[model samples]
Structure formats: C-alpha cells, structure tokens
Target: MAALILDPLAALGRATLAACRTIGDVTLFALEAVSHLVRPPFYGRLFWRAFVEIAWFSLPVVALTAVFTGMVLALQSYTGFARFNAQSTIASVVVISLTRELGPVLAALMVAGRIGASFAAEIGTMRVTDQIDALTTLSTNPMKYLVAPRLLAAVIALPLLVLVADVLGVMGGWLIGTYKLGFVSAAYLKSTFDYLEADDVISGLVKAAVFGFVIALMGTWCGYRSKGGAQGVGGATTTAVVTSSILILALDYVLTEAFFAQ
Candidate 1:
C-alpha cells in the first residue's frame, strides 16, 4: 500500500520537475533570440522574407475567418438582443466582440496553425538533416539567422493581420445587419463608430503582438530541438501548433483581464 502511494507521488513529482525544466529552457531560448536582435549584422533579407510570408501570405484566410465570424456574431447578437428589444445594440456588440476578442484570438489561432507548423517542419528538417550544424561550421549563428528574424516578423505581422481582421469582421457584420437583418445602413454605421473606442482596438493589437511572440517562440523551440528524423519533425510540427494554440487562448484571458478588468 505504501509502495503504491509512493509511486504515484513520485510520478507527479517527476512530471512537475519536467514542466519546470521545459519552462526554464524556453525562457533561455527566448532570451538568446532577443539578444540577437540588438546585435550587429542584422539579416534584412531574411526579416523581409519572413515578414512577407507571415503577413501577406496569411491574409486571405484571416480575412475569410474574420468576415464570417462577424456575420455570425451580428446574427447571434441580434437574436439574443431582440428578446429584450435591444436590436440597436447589435452594432456595438459586433464591433466590440470582434475588435476586443475575436479578431486577435481567431487571427492568432489561424497563424499558429499555419506558420507555427511550417516553422517547426522547416527548422526540424534542417536539424535532422544536419543543416543547422552546417550553419555553425560556416561561422553562422543559427539562433540569429533562423529564430530572431522570424520572431521579429511575427511580432510585427500579427498586429497588421489582426487590424485587417477587425476591419473585415466589422464589414461582415455591416453586410449582415444592413442587408439581411433589415437594419438601416446609416444607423448601423453610426452605432458602430459611436460605441467603439480606440482602446478596444489597441488592446487587441497588443494581444496580437504577444500571441505572435509566443507562437514563434514555441515553433522555433520545438523545431530547433527536434531530433530522430522525419518522425521527429512531424512531432515537432504537431506540438508547435497545439502548444501555440493553447498559449494563445490562455494569454487571451490574461490580456483581456489586464486591459478591461476593473
């Protein structure tokens, strides 16, 4: 009986220790990547490539997601508010929801699924194929070359995507409200602008930047550490997507509280 109890406790302890170790390792990795940003020999070409890949290439999907989300949000908000004779509030609801929450969260989740997996697969493949070692042999810093540029690109790109998402999402809601729901276009537009605040949009953009950092950090970390072979790369890709998605959600709550909670 004592042995059984001790075994469970030991397992828990080991898991806890492993979690702490992983956190510490990631923190160190992030610090190293950040340190490279301020150093000489910046990789402008690589940063531009990463920025374009992250921001421009990812725009279409993010746009689609935001538009549909706004349409659905307007419909749902109208449904719930109709009972209370609060239909006029739907515009504010749609705008606020998209800018303060959905825009950043959904955009980040999409990017995490797309770019995070891509980063992991690309870097993990390099690691397994010894290309990372080749970089070292060539007197190149892998962290500076491979990680820092991506991190900077993500931080800058995600906010731009979220900004576009906020606009498209609001437009979607406008379409649904004015066309399908029999709302006056002028009144709806007025309501949207009246209740919307700069802070709402600013908070979402801030959240986007942080989520971008977390996504890039996880993707690069998983990829850089991946080993074994193609299987390892596959695992890292999956792990990067899953971990970044979870972190995006968790951080969303923390940021929301920070920005809005009294």
Candidate 2:
C-alpha cells in the first residue's frame, strides 16, 4: 500500500516538473524574441509583408464572423427579452456583448486558426530545409529577421481587426433588429450608443492585443523548435493551431476577469 501511494505521488511530481519546464521554455523563447526585436538591422520589408498577410488577408473572415455573431446575438436576445416585454434593450445587449466579448474573442480565434498554422508550417519548413542555418551562417539572427516582424505585425494588426469586427458586429445587430426584429433603426442606434461605453470597447481591444501576441509567440516558438522533415512541419502546423486556440480561450477568461473584476 505504501509503495502504491509513493508511486502515484512520484508520477504527479514528474508531471508537475514537466509542465514547469514547458512554461520555462516558452518564456525563454519569448524573452529572446523580444530581445532581438530592439536590436539593429530591422526588416521593414518583411514587416510590411507580414502586416499585409496577417491583417489584410484576415479581414474578410473577421468581418463575416463579427456580422453573423451580432445577428445571432440580436436574435437570441430579442427572443428572451420579448417574453418579458424588454425588447427595447436588445440593442444594448447586442452592442455590449459584441464589443465586450464576442468580437475580440471570435476574431482572435479565427486569426489564430488561419495565421498561426501558416506561421508554424512556414517556419518549420525553413528549419527543416536548412534555410535557418544558412541565415545563421550569413550572420543573420533568425529571431530578429523572421520572428520579430511577424510578432510586431500581429500586435499591430489584431487591434485593428478587432475594431473592424466591433463595427461590423454592431452593424449586423442593426440590420437584424431593423428588418427581422421589427425594431426602428433610430431606436436601435440610440440604445446601442447610450449603453456601450468607451471602456467596454477599450477592454476588448486590449484583449485582442494580448491574444495576438500569444498566438504569434506560440506559433513561432513551435515552428522554431520543430524537427524531423515534412511530417514534422505538418505536426508543427497542427500544434500551432491547437495550442494557439487553447491559449486564446484561456487568456480570454483571464483578461475578462482582470478587466471586469469587482
């Protein structure tokens, strides 16, 4: 009996140590990336390309998700409020929910799914193909040249995407309320504006920025450390998406609590 108890305790201790080591590695990688970011030899062209790739290419999906989410929220909220004759609050509910939570969270998740996987696959391939090695031979810092630009671009673009998402989401609620829910456009707009505060919008954008950093960091770190060959690249790509998505969700809750804590 004592042996069994000790074995389980030892297993738990080992698992805890492994978790701590993984966290340490991720933190170390992030620190290195940040350190390289402030050094000389900035890559403007790479940064521009990353900005366009991560921001411009990502707009359509973000817009679509925001609009649909708003519409659905308006519909569901109207249904619940109608029973209590509180349908006038539909606009407020839609706006607050979208701006405070749905818009940023959904947009981040979408970007992580699309851009994170691409980052991992691209970087992992470079690692496997010796391109990263060639860069080092030429006295180039791979983290500075490759990772910093992507990280910077993600930080800059995600907030803009979230802003657009907020607008489109509100518009979606407007359309749904006016047409499907028999709400007057003027009343809907008034309620939205009256109830939605600047802090709510700012809080959501802050969450977007944090989520963007986590997504890019996780993707680049996974890709940078990837091994093997084509299969390794593929695995890294999958891991990037899965890990980024999970982190986005977990951080979303943490941020929400921090922002809204009483």
Give per-model TM-scores: 0.99, 0.96
* Residue 175, candidate 2: alpha-carbon lDDT: 97
TM-score of 1: 0.99
Q: How close is candidate 2 to the true structure, as a TM-score?
A: 0.96
lDDT of 2 by residue, 1-262 (tens): 8999999999999999998998999999899888878888899999999989989999999999999999999999989998999999999999999988998899999999989998998899999999999999999999999899999899889999999999999999999999998998998999999998999999999999998898899899889989999999999999899988999899989999999999
Residue 236 of model 1 has an lDDT of: 98
Clashes of 1: 0
Give the C-alpha lDDT of model 2: 0.93
Residue 138 lDDT in candidate 1: 97
Q: Give each prediction's root-mean-square deviation over alpha carbons.
A: 0.6, 1.4
- In angstroms, give how far residue 204 of model 2 lies from its true place: 0.8
Model 2 lDDT, residue 139, Cα: 94
Candidate 2: clashing pairs of residues: none
